[model samples]
Target: MLMDAFVDILRTIIWPLAIVWVSYIFRNELRGLLNRLSLFKYKDLEAKFEKELLEVEKEAKEAEKLLDRSLPHIADNEQEKIEQLLRIAGISPRAAIMEAWREVECALNDVAKQEGIRVKGLVGNSLSADKLAQIRGIPRENTDIYTRLKYLRNQAAHVPDYVIEEREARRYVQLAIHLAGVFRLKPNE
Candidate 1:
């Protein structure tokens, strides 16, 4: 008797959820049916669903744009890349700093390669800033900047609540440019 009661309770809960899921999946069909029968009664429901759908699409597009803009522009000639990062900084300092740090990491990696420094990471992968600094044998001051950049990048990437100031972002962009110059890598036009 207990087993039967439990089964009946499960069925009661499951059927509604299953119906709602199917209705959601076949919303188009439901809309058409509603249109054909008792049209006035369901008009409000249809309008509400359509409004929610439009909002979801708008949010998806904005998310796509943000992701595209946040990627580091390493291939852009150095000046252009810095400009792009600065522009992003104007809107989102965290994205700007993270992008600038990526450029710095790429510059450091290139220098390591040109100098024949063996990074500890696997082949074809860039080394972490600290590991790259060790391989390059940079001075203590340089090491400090590299470590700081690494910290900022980590926070920006992993912490949703992390914030960066515009001034700090600009400083990081300049530092990345300076470091690239030190490596003698010309930013391509």
Candidate 2:
């Protein structure tokens, strides 16, 4: 039984890792060769596009930072105070929070149509490493944040009577801040 189990793991995990390692070793050479191909003669244009793409990414990152700083991780207790923060920050606090969580989910889609890093879940599902990376210029290493927020969002939505308590809200704020930092976003000024 042990030998069979070992063989199964070798087939599923070890083989895949070996393939990826080989591909990574040749990644740079592949890029250079692709540039030399007749169909890819416009490599110079590609380089220029990369630069412009990077600039747009930077601008988006700035917007994210502005929003993160303006919105408190620990939103106040009063509805009026929350509204005031939203107004001052030029955002809808509830909407922004919900949307941010959704965005993280969509990042795993295969249809992003951009070349950048991506995070994969345990099932090998893809997430957009680009939107977050372009905005924050950081990579996602751990896969915990996605699962945790997803659980919370589901719980809140599924149970009509379940209200997010103050304690839960505070944790969300802290989680967002920690995630922002993971993506290399500095705490707002």
Candidate 3:
């Protein structure tokens, strides 16, 4: 058995060596053939790379449009409301809190829309704030902020007598602004 195995190994080695000898004997022809094959491979690789690059460029353009769409557009009236809320944050903390949450929701909806998340449907939107955070590849800390903002919004909207402090409301607004920035969508002041 050992002799047979040795013979098999020698046979394999001999075939390779014979191929090498043949190649050496026809070195010029082999070289030309190899050069042609390499050139073909290079051309194919280059074409594939160019195709991939075009795809990347197309995706980049689409991404730019998506980012533009994600930007929150504060209408003149909405900006006025924000200014009013900021001015009276102390006097009407609840209203300011509600407004801040609403702004966050608005930003979330805009981002969701840009992400192609349908809002109205039987399935509802998969790109809620949580899913958006994941899709945007946000850090855990920032995702936590998103979760907190959503919680606060839910509380202010659905929960009864959810009195939000001015400080907390301000923080929510800051988080909303941060979320907007995550998608390269700076809210127009």
Candidate 4:
């Protein structure tokens, strides 16, 4: 009877003990798997971001075609700024995306000022694509693309855990450049 009791105890303890031992032994592997899973999730997020940006670009291009005119060319200095932003993307994708969006913001503020619209706060601090679009009578389609770009920029800037890929960052910079060029055009032009 004692032997049978001992065997029953062993059976109950063995599985729990083995589980604890295996967990301890494979802790590092388990941690690595968790990290990889996190990275995989972020990869999926990055892919979705890229797809959304692509759709915005396509919409912008279609709008341009429908308007039967291309966005006016920005000045050489503006082109230089865009090139600098592209180079920055190679080093820090997040910074590049942020700076590229800043260019668009700056352009919007400048246009507002040129239109005699009173900018309420510090130069670029208070301006937004939406506000500028509403006040300046910008086309609805153009405003939509600008808003979408701003949304994507916020995703890159606000998501602490997200790592922006360099290629995607460059694409964002290109889109910002296009929007900035559009904003920089004089009303008469």
Each candidate: what lDDT?
A: 0.56, 0.44, 0.55, 0.79
- Higher-scoring candidate on lDDT, 3 or 4: 4
- Comparing 1 with 3 on lDDT, the higher-scoring candidate is 1
List, residue by residue over 16-133, the lDDT tens digit for candidate 3: 9999999999999998887666655544543543443344334434444444234456568756766676765667655665666555566667767767877752221223655765
Candidate 2 has its poorest 10 consecutive residues by lDDT at 121-130
Candidate 4 regions exceeding 4 Å error are 1-40, 122-131, 134-137
**Which tens-of-lDDT digit does each residue in 150-181 have in candidate 2?**
55545445433333333334334334334433
Off by over 4 Å in 2: 1-141, 184-189
Q: lDDT value for candidate 1? A: 0.56
Candidates in order, TM-scores: namely 0.45, 0.30, 0.43, 0.71
TM-score of 3: 0.43
Q: List the residue pairs that clash in candidate 1.
A: none
Q: Show model 3 residue runs off by greater than 4 Å.
A: 1-82, 121-127, 154-163, 183-189
Task: Candidate 2: give its CA RMSD in angstroms.
Answer: 20.7
Order by TM-score, highest first = 4, 1, 3, 2
Which 10-residue window of candidate 3 scores lowest in summed lDDT?
A: 121-130
lDDT order of candidates, top first: 4, 1, 3, 2
